[model samples]
Target: MANHPDQPAFPFRRPNPLRPPGEFERLRAHTPMTRVTTRLGDTSWLATRYEDIRSVLSDQRFGPHLHGGAMGWVGEARTGDSLFQDPPGHTRLRRLVSSAFTARRAEEMRPRVREIADSLARAMRDAPRPLDLAAWFGYPLPITVISELLGIPQEDRKQFRAWSDTFLAVSDETLAAAAQAWSDLNAYVVRLIADKRSGTGDDLLHALIAVRDEQEDRLSESELFMMAISLLVGGYATTANAIGIGALHLLHNGQLGALRADPSRVAPAVEEVLRQQAGGGEMRRVAREDVEVGGVAVKAGETVLIPLEAANRDPGQFADPLAFDIGRAPNPHLAFGHGIHFCLGAALARVELQEAFAALADAFPGMRLAVPAEEVGWSVRLLDEGPKGVPVTW
Candidate 1:
């Protein structure tokens, strides 16, 4: 698993939090699919170009295996984690919760989302000056939204959110810590599922549990537990990151003025924000058979890393790619990724972000970062990355 002498490291560092690693642009243009070594010491085909990355993502020749093992499966197959499995398992699991995240469902939730956003915005406005928006507003907004949607008790949300924060901490930091947090999280979900069976709740979890009981052939106990864990974890983390980073981008580039001026632009502005901040993690896939990527021969069992941020900024796909234009049309960025494994919560996330930024625009039209841009720290995370905290004043 040693790196080749000439092969570049898979994840180059980013000095700027808002931008992807500088190497991505050069690599994307000249050598889109170069061989590189991951931090795991595993060699992988690094795909930077949009066309090649999108092609491999859509291709059936690849599966979720990464670095010769299941991706981040610490215990019990990470059961119900659709990210680690291939279809028809991934397909079926995704189908169970897909209805809750559809565009129509998202629209239905808009009034509630607006209510939450306005409440959080008012709290932020009332808070003491120079507060961290990421902690004070960004993270809590989505966590509360998702927790309420899932029927998690208001009191239980704090405890499980703490566990999730710990669980997301690097696995190598303290294996026991992550394991215990995960176990506690799963146990809580199981208990909550049991609680739902006796009650007549109208939340998403109650409905899902009913489906499991009525059609055991479709959903198993473990899958049910895992899906709960997945939805909670997957539901908030990325959108939370997007809110923090997107807010930072608007503050830096002065896009908030345009948003404040025109309400219709907020939705498209969210899309641009999503497109610009796609540097969190690469999509990892293992070739099931010998395949060619970007004219290079990739043998079976080889790992391929697709950096979504690189593809998002590819000048070939976007004009003035680095510039954050609020009105950027035909913005087809792979922030949520492409293909079947695309994020299941995309529609909901969009609703959250759109509502979030809109509220911020109205609450603090003059909001500005309290410190130098470079002084801001990024999260020490396994999968997604974003501003650790955004200190701002209006």
Candidate 2:
């Protein structure tokens, strides 16, 4: 396989994630799918168009288990949570938690999520000037919600955060660190699983253990622990990114004032925010067979990186992709991805984002970026993307 074939160029680097060079757009327009060197040193097919992404995401030819027994790509496969599985494995795990992620279930959690959002906003109100909203609110709100739902002990949150940090710090860029973090997290989960065995609780962990014992299709010990890890880490990281980046987007676009004045707009605004700003750069999938996508033939075992941020802004799909209009109806963006791999926690994430945005709007209608937009930091190393630190003030 050629390492870096001649193709349309994109700003392909790990740093300066909040803003990539203009090359990505040029690449999408000129070459929808082409080989490019990633920060991890792997040359993968970068799919930038909307239809290509949808087709690849929905096609069963792209299997998650590309590397056989080991977790493929970002170690996410072995880390579990059904994100890496296909067919019976993914289907089964999805079924186990399907009930909890329903729209009705999320609707039920709205009040509670709002309460948490309010509490976070209240705390941020008293926060020192030029606050890091990410630390004070973004990272904790959905994390706390997930922890509460999973029945993780309140005191263990810090430990869980540490593990998650280590986990997120891994990528193709830090293969060694990623491997170590994966092992450490799996070991930690093994103990957590053992502790929860004594008696059941109302938490999801207890529910997971029940699956292990009662269900014939239950997960193995390693699978259960890793599944929990995936949920916790994925839950925390993605929501944190959305909250941080989404809030920043509102501030940048001067939407906070209008939304605060009229709270009815927060729901639709959240969808747009998620569509426009909330995402990591790309996700990895291997082409299981020779097939043409975006007019490019991808052979079996070839890799494809779906950059949601680029696609969300594709002109072919969105009329004015860069324009951040809260009332952008008919927004059929792939922010939550497409097909069966769609985010299972999408409902909960919407609830959390709506609550957080509404709370910020209510508590600090004047909230604005403490730093200039050009000065903000970005993390682009993982499956999700967001600012390094979102500084805000009211």
**Most lDDT-accurate candidate:** 1
Cα TM-score of candidate 1? 0.95
* Candidate lDDT (C-alpha), each: 0.83, 0.77
Give residue 357's lDDT in candidate 1 (0 to 100).
92
Model 2: residues with Cα > 4 Å off, grouped in runs? 5-21, 65-82, 171-180
- Model 1 lDDT on a 0 to 1 scale: 0.83
Per-model C-alpha RMSD = 1.9, 2.8
Give the least accurate 10-residue stretch of model 1, judged by summed lDDT: 65-74
Question: lDDT by residue for model 1 over 104-197, one digit each (tens)?
Answer: 9998999899999999898888889999998888988899889988988888877887888776765455656777887788788878888899
Screening candidate 2 with a backbone cut-off below 3 angstroms (N, C-alpha, C), the clashing residue pairs are: 279-385, 280-384, 280-385, 377-388
